[model samples]
Target: MIRRTRHVPQIASSEITPETVWLNRRNLIKAAAAGTMATTLPTLASQTPDLKPLSYVPGECDGCAAEEALTPLEDATSYNNFYEFGTDKSDPAEYAHNMTIDPWSVEVSGLVNKPGKLNLEDVLSGFDLEERVYRFRCVEAWSMVVPWIGFPLADLLQRFEPTADARYVAFKTLYRPKEMRGTRSFTSVIDWPYREGLRLDEAMHPLTLMAVGLYGKTLPNQNGAPLRLVVPWKYGFKSIKSIVSIELTDQQPKTSWQELAAQEYGFFSNVNPEVDHPRWSQRYERRLPSSLFKPNRVPTQLFNGYADQVASLYTGMDLKKYY
Candidate 1:
């Protein structure tokens, strides 16, 4: 059952950069240095021939606050934690272009009535996309307010008809060493094909989205082109990127981060400021596009400020214990 609570907060118009400003900024940067700007500009969607402008109803989904400023497209795309490309924040924007995403297909299998490979086109054709302004909080104590374009995960999972035995839903990222350089990097400690999972109910939550685009355009390769998951209430890592496989399993799937360091990353990594990371405090976050002169720091919220909508999901569990 999809929740009909439509009173979620909306982002203030003053905080959003006008579309014209974004275009003009890109143009100015390009005119200054064609070669340098080619890789730095936020207009990455324009470079991909197959990537098209997405049609989505604006501000339909929820979990944004009126005071939050939407992060600039450049900062959101350039600074990322896509370890499949490299461990560095700038690595994704520099190396993700090498990944091939046009003929993408996701394999749906395990404990489902219908199991098969569905092409990206087929998936998009089935649903009406909506633009959702969501607060993306990272475990590293940084955050961003992003306008994501996608449909609810519940709608897609329902089509597969998950069997009663399915207790959790597991997702996997694409792994091609030839293209993803980080897979072969000696400094990497993660097991290949980064995996993430959610309990069945959490996966079915109306707030859980399967995103294909952002900022009214198809996703840039650096930002998980073609497909990704967006669970706004949880830390950003819960939203897996470049997803290629989805499985309905009876047990909690071992996630990549948990495998790398179970003490630091838990399966139910809900945003709880009280439960600090082993090495850093989760109580505060530096919103992106921040500088040393102006830190733009803000107090972190429980469930990333979606507690009113998601607290029920963790009513009986101990967050600190699970986290």
Candidate 2:
């Protein structure tokens, strides 16, 4: 029998239906905020210069047909995965304050007809913010809900006008190990200057976001300060942080995890409870800041519990092998 806890929702096992899997707007918002709170805020509190409580209101599920979708960011900036500037999560939060990001430029090239380094301000000024509540599953087996504010990747790509030749979108993270101490670690398993990608379709999905911030504050450096990708249904690794470049290409881009272990990290790293990690079960995850005396492990869900909105995207694909 499939065992479930109090927080886990019940589902019909007869078929994989999108209508049944999608979260309502209100619940989506709750999950997003909760997830962010669980993953980011603890670290943020330690590194945040002001130690101020950022502006945030309760979020609601947006017609997702699910109850209580929102989740808070546990530690806004103190996330433990700041590989963009360095490997340790706290390293970026501390070292990134010195980064002069105002004169930033992003190179958009490869299969695109128009290729050049674009000003960061110009790129940022062009979009509107949309609050998307999504389930976040970290590779280490923790999870949260995050109400991300950003526009769809497709909306941004439309402006660039990718040629039909474009089949992939590759993102490059900022590499400054001298300033970021985590990169200097000799025993680090992850490569410096992390990279990530998506099939053209995944990149263009309405749920995918090119995020600049969370919890209504400027994105803290440790949390992919300038720009990051948010692929809700996939594992957090798919969401590359602190991106400095975005290249549209005919061939698939090399990603950090896939490079480390192709068999373990697929190009599409969607979260599926049915498939267990090599050393752990993906069936459940621990929410950060969990009560010391109580149960902390939260159940994992299909499509990270956003299947209702994105299940169709992977209709006939074999998730077990790809995962």
Candidate 3:
């Protein structure tokens, strides 16, 4: 079950380690031993065998246009970890194709001058979709390079004309039990209609994209088809998929992951290795395309390596506490 912390204490930046500053490409390679991982992992991992000894040698994180030789389309689309369809990584790709999206519409409400519902077509009527290659880092210690196509989220919020009172933006995912029959997980700890949010400034950041497509083609159902938020700096969960409702509010909204396990999944789920998870270290992550010999292991970056663009946003707040 999802656990919560009794209290969230605020700490000083002085106490916080600069885990994101270093480059540990060599350290990870040093620990790359051929061995089998015999452990019952989180529900987010693919439902494949639990004890597979990995073997392979991985290349370093290197590429152009903020992307690293985009994770092959096959792996990107097939090896997904979307729990809405099932706990298996391949569940989304196999099951989500049946999900509906053409008749979709997103409801905009709260702290907006013109709050109302707009069909998907109306939302994309005039906005321009740009292709941006971004590094996608999951909280599960894994990473991928993706070429996402979408426009700045600020463009959509501006259309509704956010009021001065709008301080945070909250988003919700679609919920259709009947359509996703295979995902009716009774043992699941998460609540339905996964929720996520961002500070007003973060939402307005040009780097924050509302993706509608990937790899030069339309979005696949498993990948949050129709629309999804892609915040590269933060962990993957912050980028809520298949958005159904978007609302602007004055107070920070309670997000799904944080609500599920307050201590494990903090509100500011930043890619900070210094602040370790209760169960594991966030200091390292595995870059995909793994085999028996090369289960890639590398040092994780602060803001997922985009600290140059987003580090300033949390000027005064304690990331450890907020997290």
Instruction: Using TM-score, give the best candidate's number.
Output: 1
TM, every model: 0.86, 0.77, 0.79
* Tens-digit lDDT track of model 1 for 1-323: 88687797789997886554465565556545666455564444223334578898865444532247789877788888898888888788777877899799999999899998889998778788888889999999999999888988898888899999999999999999999999999978888999999999999988898999988888878788889999998999999999999999999999999999999999999999999999999999998878999999999999999998899998989999999
lDDT of each: 0.86, 0.70, 0.77
Return the top candidate by lDDT: 1
Tens digits of per-residue lDDT for model 2, 1-323: 99768786767775553331242334445646767435543333234342222343333444222243445454445555765445655655555655445567777877777777767676567677655566678877886666666667887787778999999999988776765566667877877677889999989877788876676655655666667888878889899877788899899888988999887788888889988878778888876645668657888889888888778888888989777
Candidate 3 lDDT tens digits, 1-323: 98877898679886763332123323323323322113212212221111122121121222214746678765777777678898788788667765677799999999999999979777555577677788888898888888877778998999999999999999999988887744488888888888999999999987888887777666777788778999988899899999999999999999998889888988778888787888888899888766668888879988888888888898888888877
Count clashing pairs, candidate 3.
8
lDDT, residue 134, candidate 2: 62
Superposing every Cα of model 3 onto the true structure, what RMSD results? 16.9
For all candidates, what are the clash counts? 0, 51, 8
* Number of residue pairs clashing in candidate 2, backbone atoms closer than 3 angstroms, sequence gap of 3 or more or interchain: 51
User: Deviation in angstroms for 279 in model 3?
Assistant: 1.5
Q: In candidate 3, which residue ranges exceed 4 Å CA deviation?
A: 1-64
**Considering summed lDDT, which 10 consecutive residues are worst modelled in model 3?**
43-52
